[model samples]
Target: MENSIYQVYEDEIQSLEEEIKMLAEKYEDSQQESTFFSDEEILMSMKSFQTEFQGELKGQESPSDLKAQLESLEADLSFLMKFTGIWFTSHSKKTVEKTGSRTIQKHRLSGNCHSLPFQLEFQLLEIKSKESVSAVITDLNVIMESGEYSGVSKFVSSTEEHGNLLPFFKSLSSYAEWYEHRRCTFLHFKTRYPDIVKLPEGLLGDYIVLRNPEPSGFELMIVWKIHVDEDGRTTPVLDLLTKVPEQVLEQNITTIENAPTCFRSMLLLFGIETAIENLIKVVGLKK
Candidate 1:
């Protein structure tokens, strides 16, 4: 039949999309697994910094020469991303040196946390004495897409309080990882069951509705959310919601009412993907 042939093409296209998505996810995971720069690039940048610092210590160059060297060093450092899943592509800095061998610098850093982009603006005041160097960060600010960072206001507040960006980057990376997983999961199901799965908010949504292929079955919804705590811990939360007609509920009140609870139990027994697959099967769908 013409309908059957069309479905065959659709299924093939879905298969190709899944393959591409798999390759993309692998690339992203590799990026998270390794630093942006190779070992050689990092070593070169570090050695360059050493050379610049040594030149500064020589005390033989003019102030202009020192400034030029420092500027060069900063530029080099800006390109080298040494942290895993965290890298600054560009930055701006203003440095002030005091008579007591102390220096104060203000830095504005623009970077990405894995695939999630963020811009960090902060002032770093570094004080150098004969024996030691001390640093303080102030006027901390973060700019990110408001939608991407909806639930993590407390994380920002805590990061500002502690003047630490490491925790924030780590949390952001983990959160983004979970976020991608949810997105891809929804996409996979929506594509696989195009007639049965409906997304109210497109692919970026937090939930998917699974309708029965036949008219006799009730509708099931899966809600997936990624949670980030103040301590930089990330968790994925999933729940099931259902809507059944009055006739169906009257015929099977216990099953209709207990679907959510049963789903939670299934989630505990089996993982999320498996639980979702089982739930779909239970909805009287062929797949």
Candidate 2:
């Protein structure tokens, strides 16, 4: 009877193991499908937001309506940030002087710039317990370098809205990482495909323009802009320009389909090496 009971327990355990394995396989498959669908959905949502934002500007939409749209866009972007595992934490420090005492708390996030990891720092001045805060961002710093260039650039808020700083911090961090990734990608591309990719001369103002001269008379110009949004945050925007007219072009000229939805999304969809390779393919500049 003891042996029989032992055998029955062993059988049950084996059955449970098989069930768990099946469930695990199903979960992995679901996760993979979800990832692909989520990427496309996010890209489409961002493109739609950019379009509506442009229209609102042209139509002179009311402040309240614009604010609502901006809020919605921010929420969507925050969701993307969380989904991609790009997050921030609050940092606090207390300072005491002969004159007065002050506390400084900032939101900080970090990412990799090629081989180097860097942090973005942001702070809001004059905070109270629960009152609505309307003051501009005290400081925004990107501590990262690309090639020989290394320094911090201060960013000022582009909007006057007073509220939480999480959205702004997330957006700025996303943009900073995107810029770094693009710079790294450009460096790699130049090294691998030196003949096809050439950076422009002189100052370009937050834009990296690469020119590819085709055998034909027309040239292919790929422009990547570190675009600042309504909330005074930045993101990478890509545009493909050729001599061909809208009717002749294969894709929409003013759309972000040429670019990743965000830096985190780029990394999630394609790791650093694959992302660059995919960019080359998307731009149709591969030799």
Candidate 3:
């Protein structure tokens, strides 16, 4: 009789244990279901909260006070970012402008083939964060001035290359490797008056070079090693090997990097703040 009672107790305890496990699994599933939030919903919530908060803030403070508060908020936002600033571009103007011209002429086997020479110029405007650098390229309309090209202007990349041609030909990869092999660091500007060649100051690494000059320009290659300072200035380690002339540039060259650079792509993959943070850390800057 005692044995039978003990057996009954054991069976009851086992049943209870199984029940507890099932309950735990069910609770976990429910929690997971409840925790999942769609991106759209999250964005909507943020917008709603911002609107409501702004409404509540509006008449509660004077105009000057509000302005001061907004400025403070902006400063706080900036401080929260990891890295901010733009690096002036470094380029080798010779090989690009020259190579582009030679390639075009060489490919023009037929009498009807025309050689349209163009130039691309770049200026780093604002480094919103490590990842996103906002820049303005002038003279975007000159690509289709001559030759059999009709819609050449529209066929350019945002970074200012000859549309898909460079990638199609794999010229970019080749040029990047070539530049790296030569230990080149700066982008050489082989133009007339402003013969400024941009160079980086910190440890140089392989980088994609994008070009967008006013009118139209072919995308050429540029390799740079970038660094950012505490004062927010981007310093690049200069490539001491490459050199160009200060003389008048009479060569009609057409080379540009119309595709976006590696830096820009990184921004797209990660948040701007996150990208800058990585860049800052890489450059040996403090948080």
Could you tell me how far off, in angstroms, the CA of residue 156 lies in candidate 1 after the best superposition? 1.9
What is the lDDT for 123 in model 1? 77
Model 2 clash pairs are none
Rank the candidate models, highest TM-score first: 1, 2, 3
Residue 110 in model 2: shift from native, Å? 17
Pitting candidate 1 against candidate 2, the one with the higher TM-score is 1
For each candidate, C-alpha RMSD in Å?
25.2, 25.3, 25.0
lDDT (CA) per prediction: 0.76, 0.51, 0.34
Q: What is the C-alpha lDDT profile of model 3 across 141-218, one tens digit per residue?
A: 223232322223233343244223323123322332333432432222222212122223221323332232322322
State the lDDT of candidate 1 residue by residue for 113-222, as single tens digits.
66678888887777777888888777788777856567677777788788777777778889877777888888887777687788998877788888887777689889
Off by over 4 Å in 1: 1-83, 96-101, 129-133
lDDT per residue as tens, model 2, 148-227: 22112323233223432456455545665665667776777777766555667323233333333445322345556666
Best by lDDT: 1
